[model samples]
Each structure stands twice: as structure tokens, then as C-alpha cells.
Target: MTTFLTGWGRTAPTPAVLTRPRSVEELCELIGAAPGRGVVARGLGRSYGDAAQNAGGLVLDCTGLDGWTFDEGSGLVTASGGVSLHELMTALVPRGWFVPVSPGTRHVTVGGAVAADVHGKNHHRDSSFGAHVRSLTLVTADGTARTLRPGDPLFQATVGGMGLTGVIAEATFGCVPIETSLMRVDVERTADLDETLATMAATDDRYRYTVAWIDLLAQGRRMGRSVLTRGDHAARTDEKEPPAFAPGALVRAPAWAPGGLLNGLSVRAFNEVWYRKAPRRRTIVQGIAPFFHPLDFVDGWNRMYGSRGFVQYQFVVPFGAEETLRGIVGALSAHGTVSFLTVLKRFGPGSGGLLSFPMPGWTLALDIPVGQRGLAGLLRGFDRRVAEAGGRVYLAKDSRLHADMMAAMYPELERWRQIREQADPAGLFRSDLARRLRL
Candidate 1:
């Protein structure tokens, strides 16, 4: 009835039973009768860490629930839990609409996105994915489907509850109007940490989407030097012509890349070249595919991290905590961590979701190889600094945060846990993360 369990990064669990439920009823049935510590619904497994994984338990693969319908009058799209942003984008883009918020990768499922409360470059303007959600249908532990509205307290808890409350069966949210699936962007290069933050603060609001690619390998005065990319939805006049196709393309990567292929020397060289290549000022109109989901261009891109796999660490520190941000970046640089992708963004006000990850602050996300010695210790230290600054790490991207750190970061943890217990009194939905962090 079940197979093994693993995440997108292919980090296998200690052998568990995996169940692919084709419908909400099937999923509910499986969860209600699950034998182990309980069950956790898994999407496309796009989450880099164990948040979606339930070692030695039932892992419900929900990709089979991909169903969607659009309400033309309200511009609202209702999608099944398993529906992916990639699928939604392809269907909606040609119709002159876009998801209100999208993470860097489009492969994320609707359920996963809500659980993670994912944000994108536009976070400085819009906030997390949960902010746009109007309603959700959840299959509670009791096998009853309940529809939750934005104002409901349980709604906020479930938004970023990370599948702990119940299995998100369906979700309805508004879509943004767009002319073409394209973005009109401006690019700028900053010389140092202060310059980067200043530039972002100065111009972030001018663009609907904004992010900075930092040169993490740089040190001292050059520390945190970055290439800032800001963009707004492209207007009709800005586009020369409609794209020939909707750019619904997908690419896959080789099964594996050579070990140590992304070592310090290689990443440093890549970062240096990347820093130099950014122009001081430039304007470009790009397709939505390339602008929002650039990583999708290379299929199986995770292989680039090699056989050791990788973990994506994304954490946010409140505004005015520049020293905390600088300190974390400095530690990464000093450790020579070879992160292929390092992104920085300024988040706006957060949704009231108890487990929401973002707030009015600066958030940095990095992809680092898994086997780096002392990596866990380094992250623990960063966690302490973040907790001290009233910051929190994104649960969707975390695999190794300590229980005490989690409690300190999310002050409302107990509140969320109480609601979760009421919905799933027996704790029918659980994961390695939930067990490890005592959630």
C-alpha cells in the first residue's frame, strides 16, 4: 500500500511506506487508518528538506489530486491540492492572468505553497502566498472536509501549518491581471552590504518583483555586494508582440553530476563572473517563464549539487537588524560554503498566519550542499542569531533547525499547536519535522 519516502533533493528516509492517493477521499481514508506516528501529505516534494517527509510513516503523495477550474467573472482560480504552479501558469498566462504570488520554482503544488507560505520577489509589495488565499478546503483528521475563510482563526493556523492541521484538499485565490506573460525589469549592481540594502529600500516598491543576487564569497568591504533585479508586469505597449507559444516548456537534468563539481573554487569563480556581468543599469522585457522560473530552464538542476544532495536555507530577520544579516552572511563567507544560488529580498508586512515565515524584514535564501562539515553547527549558530533578532526560518526549506530554536522563533507555536490538536486530536498528521521540533 506504500513505498519509500524521500524529498525533492532525494534525501531518502529510513524506509517508509509511501501512498499516492488519487483523490481526497482516498487520502483521508489512508490518513484515518495510518498505523505509524501518523501521516503527512506530500506534494511534488519540491520542498528541499524533510518537512514533507514522514520517515517510517505514511507519506501521502498528493500529485494525483491535480484538478482546477477558473471563475471568469471573479478572476478566481480554484485548484486541487496537487495542482502545481507550473500547471496553473501555463493555463492562466495565455488568458492574461497570473498567480498573485509564486516562489522561485513553479513546480510547487498548491497545497505545498500554502503550507510553506511561500513568497517571491514581490513580497516587499504583496507578502506571502497565504495573503492571497481567499479560502481553502481541508480534510481534517476526522475525515470531514471543512471550508475555511480568510477571517477564520483556524484559517491562519492552517495557511502555514505545514500539513499538520489536515490535508489541504482545495484552495481558491485571486489572480493578478497581466497583459502578456512578460516582465519589464531593471537591473542594478551594488558595491557592498550597505549599498545593496540602501538600493533595495530606495527602489523596491517601484517594482512588483525585486530580488538581489549576492556575492556571498566576497569579504570585508565587498561583503554582500550584489546584483539587484527589479521588475513590474509588462504592459501591452512594452511587448513587441505576443509570444508564439505560451512557453510551457520543461527541461530535465542528467541523473547526476560529478562530485565536488560545485566546490569553493568553482562557486567562487562563478560568483565573481556573475558579479562582473551585472550591468549598472539596464532595462529588459522578459517572458514570465524566464523571469520567474529561470531555474526551470535546466531540468534536473538539483544534480548540480552532486550526489551529496543539498538543502535550501531561507531565514528572515526584522527590519533594522542589519547587523544580524551582515553577521550571517559573514559567517557563510568565512566558512567557504559553496551555495550556487544566494538570493536576498526585503519582505513587507506579513499575513497573520501563525506559522507564516515572512515579516517586514530582509530574507536571504541559499542552497548549500548537505555534507559540508559543521554545516549543521553553522546553521544552529545562525538560528540563535536569528531568534535573538526576532526572526524565523522558513519551515518549508528547513531540515535541521533545533526544537528550542523553533520555539523561540515562532512565539505563536503553542497557539498553532492547540488549534492543530483540536482539528486532529489524535495527531493523525505528522512528519519528521513535526516530531523533531515537537510541533
Candidate 2:
């Protein structure tokens, strides 16, 4: 059957033949019979853009391969591509273990995480999901299953390859041991962008996880006002009860919303309240759900942007490019971009994946509702500026980036393409993103 699919941002819905492969054998069989447009794996569909949408092609829904094992003594977990972080955390937290890294949302599959090399607040300390991967099994176009480990060329190509290298069948990765599911958090509000950067750079090393919520709509003296939240897992003594990992969305957005629901005026109001509500400074203990995955508390929150959808732009600049970061923020504020969710974080280092997004620097992500005036031109300018600053945008969250900027942002693109070609000479793996960016 032809199924229509879109990324979490709800943009560019495309049609494809979606299939669920129950095992490695089934996956290989499906790949062998892929249509002319080729095949790409789809997990929980949390990627904000077209990285997983294979228009008019075969879309393998790998969730059927959900199975995992944990070697508690070694803190290693061997999980099939379909297993979600939510599932893993629910099971592991009670047993005193947790995924080495987690993005803003836990609804992503193990394969999806590896494919995007997803990073989290702890990136300043632990790098990305790819860094934790011990090994991964990839089913090539020729039905050859190869288990590649770190330091292998093929492994680097597959990690952060955006599901274009091949379908991630299964993987084994190291997990972190946790004494409890709660987090000990500290909150601080920064008066401006410079203060925010200084505070984080000076003290981020003290915490395992840190992030800042910036009010992109602020201007002049108040431009870049932000709330910084940093935390680490709480010890058993911090919580009276045993660790528990049950989490669920507190509410769901309406299926239908007005296109202009998140306009400049409304988002500005929301940003003001959000900024003011965060205490100037405070220390508290929070449940895992609120600390790391607060957005997960609302199901289908993407719909809040309304039917026209939204665009997520994420980019990272090297440590010395603070001026570039400030200029971009100032531009967005001056333009009244109406981005309700703007986040800033410090990344320690890249995971060494050929196309991994992070580098030892600062990263910022913004969620802007589509159809804003001059949105395309403004973002395109940002692309040029980012590339010029030796920074790269996150492919997993991108939608509007042009192909010409790919080489400028990622110098290793050619090497990654070569390895991808060698693994699947017939080019049996493809996606709409691959077509758009010519990856």
C-alpha cells in the first residue's frame, strides 16, 4: 500500500510503500526487492525533516525487529534497530541503567538514534550516541550483513549518515549506570547572549548536562535573554523510593489548528512568560521526564504549529565563533522570526562520524513556524554565514539547506559518499533528503 509520510515537523509529506521487516532475513529480502527509487529505513519518525522520507520508494518500518538484551555486568546492550529509547529506558532505569545519551525526545528508535548520531544535553561531556555504539549490523544492497565496529570506515559512514548508507539492522552500545531516575538540577537566568555564553563556558564542565532556553524574540539590550538549566542524575540517597521509569504525555495537541496560531505576537507573549517564570537561580530535584524530555510530555506538540507546519534549524559553530553565534541570534531577533523554542548548548567534541553534527563548540536550535515572511532568504543567509564560520547545520533537523553548502559545512562529505557507494554500489538506499541535498 502507498503510505504518506512526513517528519516530526509535519513538512513535505511524501508517498512510499511502507513495509515492516520482522527480522534480518525479512529485511534483506525486502531490500533485495526494492523498487527503482531504492529503500530507506524509518523508525519512530522523530527526525524533524525528510531524512527518513523516501518518496515513491520502499520505506522499511523496522519496528518489527524490536528485541534487545542487556549484559548488566558489562553495561552493554545489544538491541535490534526497532527498539525505542523510551522502551530501553523504562526497562533499564528500574534495573539501574540508562542510555548513554538521549535527545530531547525518547520516542526515537535505537537505529534512528545511531543513524542521526543523536546528541543530548550531556554532549559537552559524553559526545553523541555514535560514541557509545560498540558495533552495528548493516544489511547492504547485495544482501551482505556486516558487523562493523568503531574505527572501521564503514562504521563511521553509517553513523550520522542519515539512513542513506544502509539500513541499520541491530547494534550493541555501552550504557550508563544510574543510582536513581531523578535529576539534581540547577537553574540560572542570563541577562543577555554574552552573559549566557560566558556562564556556560565557564561552568558547563561542572555539570554532566546543560542547556539554555533563549528568547529569540527579545531585542536591543534584552536580546538573547535566556534561562540556563544544568543537571546530573540524582543518587539513590536523593530519592526515598526505588528508581522508577514510567512516563507518559500529559496532553495532546489538537489535530487541527489555525495556521497563524503561532504568530509573532503570540510567540512573543509565550516567550515572555516562559522566561519570566524560570527562577533567577534555584536548585531542585526533578523526575527524568521533566528534566531531559520535557517536550515529550505533550503528544503531537508539533501540531501546535498548525497545519502549515514548522521548520527546525539547528547549527553548530566552533568554540571561537561566538561572534557568529551572537550575530545570528541578533538577526533572528531583529527579524522577528517568531521562534518559540530556541536552545543553546556547548558541545565538547565531534563523535568522529563522517557526517556527525557536533564539534567542540556551541550549538543552537530553533523551531520556527513555516510561512514567515522572508523566512527562506533569511535562513539561506544563515547557511552561508554558518558555512563561512566553519560550522555545520544538523542534517537530522534540516529541511531548507541547499546542496551547495553541504561540502562547505562537512569537508568529509566526499569520504562518506565513497564508503556509502562501496557498501551499496547499486545505491539501494535513498531518501528525499538525499535527493534534495545530492548526498
Candidate 3:
């Protein structure tokens, strides 16, 4: 059927022929009969940009291929491409197992996790999702399914290749064994950006997960003021058996909302309240969902940005490039950028995924509604600064990055491209992101 699709940001809607493949055989058949424009796999539409979109072409909705099995002895799971993290969590949490790495949302599919090589709050300790993958099955452009393991060039290329190498059919990955679904969390507020960075750097190793909510609107003495939270999974005790793993959505965003609803004035107020409401030095036990995927509590929350949609800008700079991070944060504050959600986290190291985003550095992500004044030029300026500082933006969340900057930001881009080209000589796997970035 001809369907219009957009990423989670809800921007740049485009039409395509969307179909669901029930199994690997059906997926191969669809790929064999693909149209001139090529094809790409999409799962849950959690990608904030066009990475999963194939404009005016065939889009294989892989959600139908959701078969999976687990081995309790090894804490390993072999799941098909379309199974979502939420589904795994719903089933595994009660069984005392947790996904090794989870992004901000649990709705992402396992295939999407491998394609993006996603990271989360525990990245300072555990690394990305691809790091836990023991092996993966990919159906390449020639319709041959290949089983790839770590250390292989093709494996490294495909892990974070953004579905460009091929369709991820299935994967075997290790999962973390948790004694309980609850997390023992510590909450604290940072006076400014310097303290935020210093505090996290000083004590990061003590906690398995850590992140800060930066108030981007704050300036002068308050510039980069933040609320920091750090935690590790709670250990089993006489706590009346672990609770069930059901996460409920408290509310849904309206189908329609007016633009300019998240302007500077409103965001500042919300940030102020949110920051003040946080406990100064409190340690509490929080549910797994609240600790890891709080945003999932609201269905279609992206609509809160209204018809203009939003742009999720995520980039990482090396450990020594604190100046670059400061400059960018200062610029955003000076512009009074209306960003309701701005997060900062520290990364330990990069997985071998050549195209994977995370590296030993500091990463920041912001959600800014589209149509913000000078948004394009401001971000373009950031792109230049990031490239010069030896930093790279996350491809999964990128929509407006210039094609020329890709190679400069990712030093191994050429290598990744070579492997991708070899795996899919016909370039059968294509997406709007690839076309726009000239990949």
C-alpha cells in the first residue's frame, strides 16, 4: 500500500510502498522484486530521522518477523529482526534478565538496536548494544544470508551500518542478569556545566548508569545548570519478590497541536520547575521503566512539538575537547534555544562498529522544534565546530547534516563504505539518509 511515513520526529513525511514480511524467505522475495529505488527496513519508527525511510520506494516493515528464543544457562537470546526491546523487557524482566543496552525508549526493535548500535545511560560502563552481540544473520544484496561474528570487517560494518549493509534477519546477543527490576538511584543537582562535567568525571565509575538533564535556557551564572542521576540495578533482598514488568502509558499526545508551543518562555518555566522539584541529594529505588525509559510513559509524545515537528541533534566530542562542548552549550544558551529535552552523558569507548556513534568522550542530545529562528544556520555552525574538534554526530538522530561533513566526522567512513559496497554491490539497501548524505 502507498503509505506516508516519517521518523519519530514526525518531520519530512514521504510516501512509499510499505509491506510486512512474515519470515526471512518472504523478506528475501521482497528484496528480489524490489523496485528501482531500492529498499530499507523499518522497526517501530524510533529513529528520529530518515535512516529507516526509503522515499518513493519499497519499505520492508520487518515487524512481522518477531520470533525469538532464549537460553537461560548462557543468558543469551536469539531474536528475529523485528522484536522490540519493550517486548523483550516485558518478558525477561520478570525472569530476572535485562537487555544489555537500552536507548531512551524501549520500543526500538532488536534489528534497529543493531543497525544503530544504540547506547544508553550505562555506556560509561557497559558500552553499546553491538558490543553484546555474539553474532548476526544478514541477508545481503545478492539474497545470500551470511552469519557474521565479531572481529569480521563485514560484522563491524553492518553493526552500525544503518541498514545499508543488508537487512538484519536475526541476532544472538548476551543479556544482563538482574536480581530485581528496581534500580537504586542517586539524584543530585549541578550548579553549572563545569560542576556537572566534573562530578560525573570524578565518580562515574561508581555507578553503572549516569545522565544529566541540562537546562539549556540558563545563562550567565546558571548556564548549563543540570540535574544529575546515577544508578545501578537493585540487588535482591527480602523485598517481597520482584514486581511484574508491565509499563503503562499514562497519557497520549493530542493528534494536533499548535506550533510555537515550546517557546523559550515556556521551556524556561518548565525547566525551572523540573530542576527545583528534584531532590538535592536523595537516594531512591525506582522502577526499571521509570529509570530507563521514562519517555515511553507518554504515547506519541513527539506530537507535543506540534505540526512543525522537531529535530534531535546528538553529537559527541573527545574527552579533551571540553572547550568545544562548552562553546556549543554557550551558543545554545545565548540563542535562548527552546529545547525541552537536553541530555548529557559520558561514553567509555566505541564498539568495533565502524559506523557506531559512541566513543570515549562526552555526548549531548537536544530536541528542538523545527522552524526555530536561525535553526539551520546555528546547527550548520555546530556541524563545522564538531568536525574540527574530531567529533561526530549520531546518524540515527541526524536529518540536516551536510554530506561533506560525514567523512570528516567519522574517520573510518571510507572503510565502512567499502565494506557496505562489497556486501551490497547493487546498492539494494538504500534510505533517505544515504541519499541525502551521499553515502
Candidate 4:
């Protein structure tokens, strides 16, 4: 059927021939005889941009392939590409097992996680999602199914290859062992950017997961005030048992909202109230959902940005590139970019997924409505600065990045291209992101 698809950000909606195949064999047949527009695979479509979108092409909706098997002894789970992390956790957590990593939301599918090489708050301690992946079952351009391990060049290519390597069929990954479903969390309100960074640097190792919610609208004396939260799984005790499963959506957004619902004035007010509500210093136990995936609680919350949609700009710079980070933050504040969901994280190391987005350094993500005035030119300028500073933008969250800056941001893009070409010389796997970035 012809369908209009967009990423979680709701930007760059495009029409495509969408089909769902029940098994790997059916998918292979579809790819083998795909139309001239080419074929690409899609999961839950959590990527904020066109990574999962293919314009006027065959987009394989892989969710129909969802299946899973778990081994309690080894804490390893083998699941189909279409199975979401939410599904895995829903079943595993109650059985005393948890996904090794959890991103901002659990709505992402296993295939999507491997393709994007997602990272979570625990990134400072654990590596990316690819690091825990044991193997992958892939259907490549030649319509052949192959099992790949970590050491293979194609394996690295497929991990963060953004689904360009092939359509993932199933994957095996190790899960973490958790005694309880609650997180012992510590929160601190920072006065400014310096304190926030300093505090994170000084005490980040004490916790397994950490992140800071920044107030970008604040300028001058308070340019990066933040609410820093860090936590680790609680040990079993005589205390009451925490909720074994994450909570589902509580309320859905209205059918429609005004385009200016998240303008500078509204965003500033929200940020002010959010920042003030957080305590100066507090330590408490919280549910897993509230601690890790708070946004999931509000159904279709992206619509709050309104019909114009939103742009999620995520970039990372090396540890020594503090000046560049400060400059970007200052520019955003100066422009009064309307972003209430701004986040800052410290990444530990790259997982060597040729096109993967994280490394040992600092990364910041912002959600700005598409209709913001001069937002394009402003972001383009930031792109140049990021490339010059030896930084890279996250492809999973990118939409407007130009082809010229891709190689600069990701030094291994050429290597990734070589591997992807070898895997699919006929260019069977394609997406709007690949076309836009000339990948």
C-alpha cells in the first residue's frame, strides 16, 4: 500500500510503497524483485529523521517478523528485528533480567537499535547497543541470508550502518541482571554551565547511568543551568518490591495543536518551571519508566510541537572541545531557539560501528520546531563549526545535514561506504537519509 511515513520527529514526511513480510523468506523475495526505486527496511520508525524513510521506494515494515527466545542461564536473548526493546523488557524484567542498555525510549525495535547503534545514560559506563550484540541474521541485496559475528568487517558495517548493509532478520544480545525494577537516583540543580560540567566530571563514575537536563533559554549569568540526575539499580533488600514493568502511556495528545505551542515564550516558561521544580539536592528511589523513559508516558507527545513538526539536532565534540560546546550553547541562547526538551550527555567511547554517532566526549541534543525563523542558516553555521572542531552529528537524529560535512563529522564514513558497497553492490538498500547525505 502507498503510505506517508515520517520519523518520530514527524519531519520530512514522504510517500512510499510499504509492505510487511511475515518471514525472512518473504522479505528476501520482495527485495529480490524490488522496483527501480530500490528497497529499504524499517522498524518502529523511532529515528528522528529520514534514516528509516525511503521516498518513492519499497519500505519493508519489519515489525511483522517479531519473535524472541531467551536463555536464563546466559542472560542472552535472541529476537527478531521487529521486536521492540519494550517487548523484551516487558517479558524479561519480571523474570529477573533487563536489557543491557535502554535508550530515551523503549519504543525502538531491536533492528532499529542495532542499525542506529543507540546509547543511553549508562553510555558513560557501558558502550553502545552494538557492543552487546552477539550476532545478526541479515538479508542482503543478493537475497541471501547470512549470520555475522562481531569481528567481521560486515558486522561492524551493519551495526551502525543505518540499515544500508542489509535488512536485519534477527539478532542475539546479552542482557543485564537486575535485582529490582527501581533505580536509586540522585538529583542536583546546577547554578550554571560550569558547575554542571564540573559536577558531572567529578562524580559521574559513582553511578551507572547519568544525564543532565539543560535550560538553554537562560543566558548571561545562567547560560546552562541544569538538573543533573544519576542513578544505579538498587540492590535487593527487605524494602517493598518496585514495579516490575515500565508503565504504558497515560494520556494522548489532542488530535491537533497550534504551531506556536512551543515558541520561545512558552518554552522559556516551561523550562523555568521545570528547573525550579527540581530540588537543589535530592536522593530517592524511582520507577524504571520514570527514570529512563519519561517521555513514553505521554502518548504522541511529539504532536505538541504542532503541524510544523520539529528538528532534533544532536552533535558530539571531543573532551577538549569545551569552547565549541560553549559557543553552540551560547548561540542557541542568543537565538532564543524554542527547545524545552534539550539534553546533554557524556559519552565514554565509540563502539567502532563505522558510522556510529557516539565517542568519548560530550553530546547535546535539542528539539526545535521546523518553522523557526532562520533556523536553517543557523544550523548550517553550527554544522560548519562542529566539523571544524572534529565533532560529528548523530545520523539517526539528523535530517538537514549536507553531504559535504558527513565525511568530516564521521571520519570512518569512507570505510563504512566501502563495506556497504561490498555488501550490496547492486544498491538494493536505500533510504532518504542516504540520498540526502549522498551516502
Report the Cα lDDT for candidate 2: 0.94
Model 1: per-residue Cα lDDT over 1-439, one tens digit each: 5566556666645456777888888877887788756888889878877888777778888899989999878999999999999888888877778899988889999999998888888888998899999999999988878999998978989988888998999999999988866789998899998999998988898889999999888988898899998998888888756532255437777787877888889989999999999898899877787788889788778888777788888899999998999889999988888889999999999888999898999999998887887988898889999999999998888777888887889999988988888888888888988887888
Q: What are the Cα lDDT values of the candidates?
A: 0.86, 0.94, 0.93, 0.91
- Candidate 3 colliding pairs: none
Show model 2 residue runs off by greater than 4 Å: none
Worst 10 residues of 3 by lDDT: 235-244
List model 2 lDDT by residue over 367-395, tens digit each: 99999999999999999999999999999
TM-score of each: 0.97, 0.99, 0.99, 0.98
> Compared with the true structure, what per-residue lDDT tens digits does model 3 show for residues 66-123?
9999999999999999999999999999999999999999999999999999999999
| Cα displacement (Å) at residue 319, model 4 | 0.5
Off by over 4 Å in 3: none
